[model samples]
Target: MIRAVPVLLTWVLAAGPAEMTPLVTEAVIQAPPEELWRVLTTAEGVLKLGVGAADIDFRPGGLLRTAYDPKVPLDSEAAIHTEIVAYDPGRVLVTRIHRPPKGFPFMNAYARVWTVFTLTPEGKGATRLRVAMVGYGPDEESQKMKAFFEKGNAWVLRELQAHYPGGR
Candidate 1:
């Protein structure tokens, strides 16, 4: 059971004003949108997350598969597979978990969540990256899942920002 890996998802810009606020994280990177796009849509780029191996099908309905254990094959149950929901070149990318790894906690709440990444050009070869996680239900479990993502997603964006340090 994969009880310790970060979860992923995308969709629902806002559940509703009456609902819980979505978990949104943002960072400014020292790279162009195209540069970031390359990393976002490629296997090597995702490995920056410290995964062992990954394969990306970068299109709507495509799959982004990853395994934290380098020795594990992508097709194995320990890998995580996310479905690309929608994307615009160097602009926005959204995804939802197509199939979670074994032993993943929060299956019920996990299925209802999604994640979206937005890229905006900041002056001087920099891009502002914003990630939003949405679609949480109003329940204790949902709240827990949401909290988990708030930290996980923020950490991911930080890692990405680090990837393009000092206007690289």
Candidate 2:
């Protein structure tokens, strides 16, 4: 009765932006965390994701880069820009993407994105690996990216699992 309609609209407006649906995935590997950590911190391992040409320093704030041509397939790229945001030996590795050359025209149009990987030791010579990534863009566009990361992480887990001493 006393401007109740206005009050309801104000409450809805104050709810703020919707929570982002984070892209996450996990895998259990027969390899030790140390072995997995090495691959996670190196350039050769980075190539598997089709991210970019990598020059990884493997330390906190260390340089991580990948380069690729915008016109060609991403895997053929010669360079891509990335930075090491966090590096916890044998446990976690996180990086902020600077400029992604391969994912252009669709995935990496807006703000920067970050990827984090956590490795937990499991009983009897096994490890639990988790990957979490966040990306920014309009909801419609971001959804496509979310799906990409989901599939990519799945492929990564499969590849890593195969690399284990005794295949699963």
By lDDT, the best candidate is: 1
- TM-score of each predicted structure versus truth: 0.83, 0.69
Write the residue-wise lDDT of candidate 1 on 51-163 in tens digits. Answer: 77999988778999999898888988989999997777789898878898998887777777778889999988988888888778888878888888888877777767666
Residue 21 CA displacement from its true place in model 2, Å: 4.3
lDDT of 1: 0.78
As a TM-score, model 1 comes out at 0.83
lDDT of 2: 0.65
Worst 10 residues of 2 by lDDT: 68-77
- Pairs that collide in candidate 1 are 1-103, 2-102, 2-103, 9-114, 9-115, 10-114, 10-115
lDDT of all predictions: 0.78, 0.65
Collision count of model 2? 9
User: How displaced is residue 8 in candidate 2, in Å?
Assistant: 36
Deviation (Å) of 125 in candidate 1: 1.0
Q: How many steric overlaps are in each model, in order?
A: 7, 9
